[model samples]
Target: MRIRHPGALWRGAQAAALAAAVCIGGFGTSGEARAEYADVVINNYSDAAGMRPVIFPHWFHRIRFRCKVCHADLGFQFKAGGNEINMVKIIDGQFCGACHNGDIAWSVENCNLCHSGKPGTPTQVHESTIQKLAIQPQAGGQQ
Candidate 1:
């Protein structure tokens, strides 16, 4: 057999690693893109005191409900910080409680589902989500 160039081997290895990352899903998925999910992030935003309220990752809700379910019925306000949602109201069947009374999205036992605000932390399942999206096919056929 002929000897192979070291540079070529490295390049091939790099490409394989990238493909594996994309495939094995430490990066993102290919299905979630078109899956029609909602992000809790600032499709809407408001200033408070000084800092931003919090970014809501819509993808978080995608696995749970449809857009109308929360935006129209639950009164999620469509935009971040737009709806009058909070822990107290959620517990009382006002905002999140519109369904979360153990019948939908999850139960009150999973309070941080909305309050955690961030993704992929101990509280929120956002990081795993990022990987899920990475592997998912892009929405509308665009990369």
Candidate 2:
């Protein structure tokens, strides 16, 4: 019999949890893996400010970033409206500010970046594309 390191076990568990969250909650099962959502609206505080709901284009982000980058590393929840992001936390470099710090991507000061109530104008990625990208690797091909 062989003993496994505790740290290795912990990492394995975390990876499993992340995989479950992605497949079950976020992306759904293989058969049901279609378009979960085209965009996410951030209205946690928009109404209070009398502003339009911020439309987050899922397709736009998915194209450039891996799901793990935002979902696991940045701590964004799997479901829409799951992450309670606010302006204060953002300015403090918490949620959106994590990358939109005027360095990694764009400055949060660029209000139009997120505040656009309309769908993003960037290239749209279909659900099939996403599903293929996420599942192909597990099926023995590149992700």
Best by TM-score: 2
Q: lDDT by residue for model 1 over 37-122, one digit each (tens)? A: 33333212222322233345566656677888866776665443466555577688887677668776476675344443322211
Q: What TM-score goes with each of the models? A: 0.39, 0.55
On the 0 to 100 scale, the lDDT of residue 76 in model 1 is 63
Lowest lDDT block of 10, candidate 1: 117-126
Question: Candidate 2 local accuracy as lDDT?
Answer: 0.63
Q: Could you tell me the lDDT of residue 100 within candidate 1?
A: 68
Q: What is the number of residue pairs that collide in model 2?
A: 0
Which 10-residue window of candidate 2 scores lowest in summed lDDT?
118-127
Give lDDT: candidate 1, residue 109.
76
Candidate 2 per-residue lDDT, tens place, 1-143, comes to 23389887888877777677676668544443243456665566665576655767777888989889888888988765668888888888887788888888887778876886533222222354254335332211212
Candidate 1 error regions (>4 Å): 1-38, 41-56, 117-143
